[model samples]
Target chain A: MKSKTIKASATATLINELDKALSDGFKPTLAIIFSSIKQDWKAVCNMLDERNIKVFGATTAGEFIDGDIEEGSIVVMLLDMNTAYFKLEFLETSEKTTFEDAKKLGSIGKKTFSNPAFILATGGIFIDGEHVIDGITEGFGSEVTVFGGMAGDDLIAEKPIVFTNNKSKDNAIVALIIDKDKIDVRGIASCGWEAIGTTKTVTKSEGNIVYTIDDKPALDTLMKYLGVEVKLDETQEIVAFLNSWYYPLQLERENGDTVIRATRFANQKERSLICTGSVAQGSKIKFSLPPDFDAIETVVSECKSIKDNPEQQADALIMFSCVSRHLSFGALMQEEIEQVQNIWNAPMVGFFTYGEYGRSKIGNNEFHNNACCVVALKEKA
Target chain B: MNQNLQTILDFIQQSKHLSEDEKATLTKAAKDADKALTISEFKLVRTEKVKRTTAILLEETIEELEHKRKAIEDSNNALQKSLKELKATQSQLIQSEKMASLGELTAGIAHEIQNPLNFVNNFSEVSKELLEEMQEELEEGNLEDVKEIANDVIQNLEKILHHGQRADGIVKGMLMHSRSNSGEKESVDINNLVDEYLRLAYHGLRSKDKSFNAKLETNYDDSIKTVNVVPQDIGRVVLNLITNAFYAVNEKNLLQETQGDKYEPTVSVATNTMKNNIEISVKDNGNGIPQKALDKIFQPFFTTKPTGQGTGLGLSLSYDIVKAHNGELKVETKEGQGTKFIIKIPII
Candidate 1:
């Protein structure tokens, strides 16, 4: 099997990357991830239109796919898996999918696909990823594979976007069905950060704004843990210090140089910490600092093993990654992207996520805080 | 899934064409194909239609229940709001009544004081005139008229003291009524107390609103000697009624001013002695209470005054002051007619 890789720095650059991949006979099955910038959405959508590509993506706090974080880019990975049995249908209906709605929709989708199919969906407004899981569970009955993330808006993490093949919308949910006979998909989620330091409990918490932790103000707790004073006026510079090894607060990966586990949105006003996963009251939290050089090398080495596997030799691949890793590894994040490109030998596109969801290295549905999730889909044997 | 399966089977059956014998054989074959499927084809389809109809009915019932729940919640909120408004009105009415009674007592005291002062002014002028005339006669060689001059001086001095004492008596009466009249509760002889104040209050009113000609009547109870009361408070209540009677007559003068019709104003003071209590009333024939002002008359701070002349605290304070003594203060009045105030006190 032969593969192609597409790379772009910004959303405008995605069109050229796709054109190049398409020109190389890469019949692209598109997967995209994006952060919430009010601008560039329309431009990216138009570019996708000109390229005749169907988009499936969600608004995120930040996007990292295949290791690179696209601040304003729509990272599109185009794939061509020549399988006649696989059918792609874009379903767009106005009816809000309650449990009943999902059940109905699931039944319709199931009729078109065989047993052991994957139901990949993007959540609607105010819908949690759990609801999407629940809807798919009801519609297709208990015995179906379901996976997706609730959409996110930048660091605000408020309104989520559900991208259909046609356009981006706020109040819509989209599902992509993959039949078992058509594709064999394998998903793995991993991060390089290892839990270190003492634990901190979220003292005061609200939906996304966690104002304090450990009974102290959230910003104050972050400042104290990092040891160095950060000027809030220079947000990016202070955020750059998020992965500064001299004053690292995030938990580092014990096995690799993957993540620094950035404290994304901490609310000093409410005394709480809002990370990717569920942080309970009175739960202990520790910082994952930047990883060592050898750990970074180890992560690439492990991902290379996925390339060596006979089953993963797919015509295409899609990766979803956390954006905080880029700040932790700096230029090394680019190295991780290049490594995935060299090993997978396929068209790769993904966005940095606020949170990551994938099967663990041993295959269990897991919600990750700071990790990268790689899914390689190939023609079924 | 069930509906689709049924539709598919129906479609297959509708599409078939066969010879008469063949059709019969095929139909028989379809019936024996699967026992459960044969039963479902015959019985379950009809039952399923009924179930669908019932489900629609159930949906309607749920909607109706939700509507009723919302209506009940709205009514509860409305009822709570109205109850709060009612409580506020009751408290305001009670407070208003208290102040009105106090105003009436004050007006009575003012009228009582004014009467004696009018007499003092009238008599003092006469004394001044007599002393001047004596001085003139002495100046005209009346040195032998010393006895005459001394007699005149002593007579004038005695007249001054008489008028001075009358004014002092009226002031003392007011002070007694105004003092801690609510505190000193005692058994009072109702007939005696009413007769005394009626005489004093009437004479006092006649000195001021002189056009006030009310026929006074007394139906005093001789048997009921004493009742439980604060004497000073009881006296104040008597004074209030008498003063109100005189004012009612004065108001008639206003009607006379507009109509120019002669109407007689009469005040009747009566007391009935009972075995356990005594009832005293002061009735008047004049312009009575108007229908609109009736409800508000007993409310404090509510006045029909032109300002600077009256404080509307008479009847309300009287209601409380009377109620405090375990007695009733009642009124009977009609427009363009007359008014009567009846007070009943227990003989303990």
Candidate 2:
């Protein structure tokens, strides 16, 4: 197997670059695209289709190649793996149909490959990410392999689209199913944010909207603790943009691994907070402070430990990072990406996402927020 | 354990049917399998521990959520019996506004349905009495008086049928108002609804507290027959306002009795037809709301009443409901004299 990477800002550049890469008769059979929503994704899909490459594409908040991070650009990783060993599938989804659609995809993956490793990128605002993972696990009859990220539309939050060769949908899911026995798949999710306060009980919550924490209004409690003063008015739209992303709640799991849930928006009328993930009432949660630069070290080390290859080699690498990290770390986010990229010293393609999906440090396949998920693929020896 | 592998190796060594090359190959494969099995067992153990702990967390989370959900459903349904009984009124209020609207809805249904029913019963009895009078008049052979008596009986019977049909309309209208299309504005008899809920709120209070009693008054404009509005939404606001009036007066009655001062607890409701809009006002001769609290009365979860007694969502929702109709909700109050709440909706 062989892999090639390309980064382009225009369709003409993408086509020109593809012509140059194919000049050597590499003849790639699969193309994985991470592109900005501002780019013309349809044209890129058409060019790849002309080459007869199976396309697995998602719109990204930001994209990267190797050591450089680019915004509003296109990054492609072309693989020449046997198409017989993998299949690309796409489907539209809603709050009602997301689980069933994912379940069907899982069943299809099982039928296609005896040992399947599923990779996904979902698009939709109100989709419960955990349900996707759960449906796949149930349909496959057990956990085999699952990893992916939710799609993003830069910071607009309007529409994050996922596409195939000819069709595209904003509220949809795109998946890649690989024969894991043929292509050894390994990955890990790392969150280095540190908890700052004592655990508090969620007193009143329904779904992802929390009304209160520790017997006080959730918005007021967060404001007082964070020392923020915003007038409670009918039209106030305070949310993570006001530094809540830096201090998202750290959910303490009984498995001894803490996961994060970001409060994305607030309701001035109801005195509640809307979280990106659900926080069950009576669950113990604590505030988190953004990590120091050393957080990058934790991520890089975790990436290294997942290396099954004795030489720490990888044919292709992909990353799914939460967009909040980009917003909070600013330019420093590049440093973290560089360190993770250096671990395997291989061609890589990645994007900042709305949320991350991968196995935790405890090896539990779960959906995560404000996390960095890195996956490495290599064919068996 | 590795003991099984050691046992297998020992069996291979003792067998006589194997060549030296086969024995060497078998030994290496057995050792590799043993090593892989050990590592797999360790990973399996770790996975099982995490799964067990996660199961505990899931159980606790589900149990706690179920308990809270059930409690909220119960408190919300205490006064919403009539809503379910009139199941045809499937309002979208069942989602976020459900907790606030349920009790208020029953109060409206309870108060709105009672008026025409009382009239029906009274008219029925009157018709029966007039029937006996006609019989006597006919027996005396007074033809002129008999004819007058017969006309009176016919009038009584007509009144009975009118009241009976009115009762039926009230029931059907409520059912219609609760449907998913409850948001659409419909022509409704504002005076009839105001009058109905006023009595209904009083009876609801009386049934709860046998010792609680107050004077109820109505000053409805006869000319204002029907106003364009969503009947259920308007009914909720009116019922909340009237119910609060009764609560205030009852509180004052209790205080005045303890103070050894004579007091008359009166709650009066009036509907006025304005030039461009209609105004519904509820007044209570009890201790008025505080000046400081006037601004926050319409804010959700801000309550002047004691905890567990007031949800603090009633007035806030009432204010929103009125605004959704492009109307205004305002209050007039004196610290000790009284309070009046006025709601004005456009004529359209």
Candidate 3:
């Protein structure tokens, strides 16, 4: 298998780069695009469709290209493989149908591929992403490799767009299924943030809206920890939501793996927290501090361990890095991405997403926020 | 750019192509440069040592602060525990004090009322006997009109005797309420105790509120054998729960009247002998406790009544009494519906 990555700021530039990579008797079987929301997604989809290329992608907060990360640009990874088969599926989801839609996608992939590596992307603003994984895992079981991310809107906090060659959808999940006899897929999800303060139980919650923590209003408890005066009557909803990016709730799963969920929105009138994903009532959660320089090292190290496996040669790499990491690391995020780039020195493409989806070391597949998920696909020789 | 340094640099630059004697001079200058580098390295090491020491001290101080914080937290927890115990003791003392005062007043009233009650009983009996003797004389056909009037007097005396006995029963109940139990266990009839308290509580509330009335009901299992308990303490618990039940129904009744709704206020006391325990339940159809306040109903100083109406210690003290008897007190309630307090004491 062979792959190539290209970065472009405009449609023409993107097409030009694609042309260059598709030259020399190379015909891409699939193209994975991660474009900024500012780019013209319709035009880009039309251009790829004209070339008879199968396309799957979503808009991103920021795109990762070559060895650098850039905003307002598009990154595409085109794969030219010998024996692997690729299938794309899209399912529209809403608050009521997210789980069933995920299950439907899973059942479709199960019937289509014998050995499948599933890649998924969905809108980040609504829908409990955790239950989506639950539904898929229910159908595909724990043995199937599942990895993906929730689509982002460049920190605009609006709806994000996901697309296949046929149509673009706002609240939908787009999946890429890879069935191969000789390709090996592995992934790692890691969050380097440390928990601060004491653990608190979710006292009152319904779905993704948490009304109380430790029997206090969830918003008030969070504000108390942040040392910010809780202004219930004031218009501080936006500030509260923005401030929550630094202190996501870290929930430990029954299997001993931890997943972080950040507050996507705040209800001022109700004084509740709307998380990126659902948290169970009575679940113990801890507020996590922002990642320091050591976190950069930890992520880089995790990437290297996967990339430097002597037994397998990595051919393609895809990353779902949480946008909160960008806010936490600032310019140092570049070095962290570069360090991972140095590991495989291969074709890589990714985007900073609102939430990431991957399996941890000791747990089943999970959806996470404020963490980095790295997927490395290698072709067995 | 010093003269000596410049000469050394120039010799090193020219040393590659120089003779052995010039190379020897270059070697000497190189050794001097090595010495200067060593000196700088030593200075850096010393600076790093100071920084390392300072960092170590800071870490130790942070550790000390953490320890102190934990100590303070533990101390605060201990103090909070002590405060809780103190409050409980205060509540117990207040309840005991209230009972003591009520006992003193009831004892004095009983003493004063018993004297007149005895006289009423004695005089009524004497008057009935004299009326009977007159009826005999009338039967002998002498003073028939006088005999008829004596019959009316005897009937009135009988009425006075019946009412006096009823008042005496009430006085006895009040005296029992004021009596302190010695915590001695005895095989007491649970049915009789519950029945007595039900009437006492109902009449007690009726006396306080002229309009308050409730339909009191009881269902006692005939097969229920007597259980060992401190009769006085158990009686107090029964009375407290029954009184609350009446109060709840009365409140609901008042509300129903204002809402133009007809509701029959009812309070029921039931006893059933289970396989291993005796279950006594006091149920009332009244405005139930709200959900937020339900969990704290048995807590001292928690009450829904208006000020000066309730001490809020009735349920709390009753709870302690039941718990001390190795029994469990449980309540099930629904807002705007009713509440049921169930007490289960082990047969053993």
> What digit string (tens of lDDT, one per residue) describes model 2 on residues A18-97?
88888998989999999999999899999899989989989998988886888999999999988887899998888777
TM-score order, best first, reads 3, 2, 1
Model 3: DockQ vs. true structure: 0.02
Q: In candidate 2 chain A, what residue range of length 10 has the lowest lDDT sum?
A: A233-242
lDDT of 1 by residue, A1-381 (tens): 234544455665766676776775656444444545543666666666565555566676555545555564455554444434344443443323444555555786788776545424343333333344455567776656544444555544445565755666655555556666667765566666654444556566543334566576866656554443433443332232232222223422334322222444443334344443333444445654434534556666666655546344666666666655554454456667667656666656665554555554544344454566666667766
- In angstroms, give how far residue B168 of model 1 lies from its true place: 99
lDDT of 2 by residue, B24-62 (tens): 999999998886786567446534543543454446446
How would you encode candidate 3's per-residue C-alpha lDDT over B1-348 as one tens digit per residue?
A: 345666777766676678778777777777677656654554465345434434543464466569779999999999999999998988577557458435433433455456667767777777777777777777877787666767767676776777677677667766555655567888988998788667655655555566877888899998887999887778778877887888899888888899999999999899998889999999999988898998899998788889966778778877988998899999999888999999999887
TM-score to true structure, per model = 0.40, 0.51, 0.54
Interface RMSD of each: 30.7, 14.4, 12.9
Cα displacement (Å) at residue A23, model 1: 5.1
Cα lDDT of model 1 by residue, B14-86, tens digit: 6556456765565555544544454445345434543443354345446545866999999999998998988
After the best TM-score superposition of candidate 3, give how far the Cα of residue B110 lies from its true spot, in angstroms.
36
In candidate 2, position A173 carries an lDDT of 86
Ten contiguous residues minimizing lDDT sum, candidate 1 chain B: B94-103
Best by lDDT: 2
Candidate with more favorable, higher TM-score: 2 or 3:
3
What lDDT tens digits, residue by residue, belong to model 3 across residues A1-381? 888888899989988888898777788777899989999878878888897778889999998975588899888998875434768888888887888888888788789888788888897477798878877887777777788898988888787889989888889999988775566777888788777555678999988889999788998777656533433436455333766776789987776777888987788878899998988999899877675556778887876676546455688989899998887666567777777766777778999998889876556778888888888887777
**Per-residue lDDT for B279 in model 3?**
92
Residue A367 shift from truth in candidate 1, angstroms: 2.3
